[model samples]
Target: MVLMLGFVTIVAAALAAGYLLGRLRPWRRAGDWAADQVRFTGAWVRGGVVRQAVVVLVHVVTAPRTSWRIMRTPAADTTAPVPVRDPDWVAHRTRADKGGTP
Candidate 1:
């Protein structure tokens, strides 16, 4: 009977741990998503014709001339952009998507 109780307790703990980790998955991804957005925005702001020209000039002026290897890599077709929507808009959209009148 005590062995059965021990087994039940272990099963309960495993289930509780699984539930907590499942709940944490979204929060972990949210942090990563926010970081990606910030990096993308920073890169967008930094990238411009002027920056490109400066980079070109620096490369040209450097003494050791290096041959650029232009590799034609296939574009990423799998990853989709994360949709940014207001909480209220999301709630409405969720309801609308479910065929409920929002």
Candidate 2:
């Protein structure tokens, strides 16, 4: 109980000191300066957010059209047999492409 009272008294005293200091000229000026800095930082953050949103919007608008163009294009004919110069390298390449132990 004594400890609790001590804590409450300390909190009240701190609050009162803060209230009195906030009324002083220097403290009020400091608070205003801090608020201005916060506002400046907030504006920068908002600008970055807006720029990211615009980039995402552009990607959203272009992605489907780009994908559709790719899909509509004819695939190249690859029926001709290409001779592998090195069978060992070809086996390793195939294994790597399949994401197996290479």
Backbone N/Cα/C clashes per model? 0, 0
| C-alpha root-mean-square deviation, each candidate | 17.2, 20.7
- Clash pairs, candidate 2, are none
Tens digits of lDDT, candidate 1, 13-97: 9999999889888655644544443335565247687754544444333412331321134546898889986778655566668
Q: lDDT of each structure?
A: 0.57, 0.60
lDDT by residue for model 2 (1-102), tens: 999999999999999988887688664464454444333445434667675454334433445464356458897787668876865775557666888876
Q: Give TM per candidate.
A: 0.32, 0.26
Residue 30, model 1: Cα distance from true site in angstroms: 7.8
Model 1 misplaced stretches (Cα beyond 4 Å): 26-102
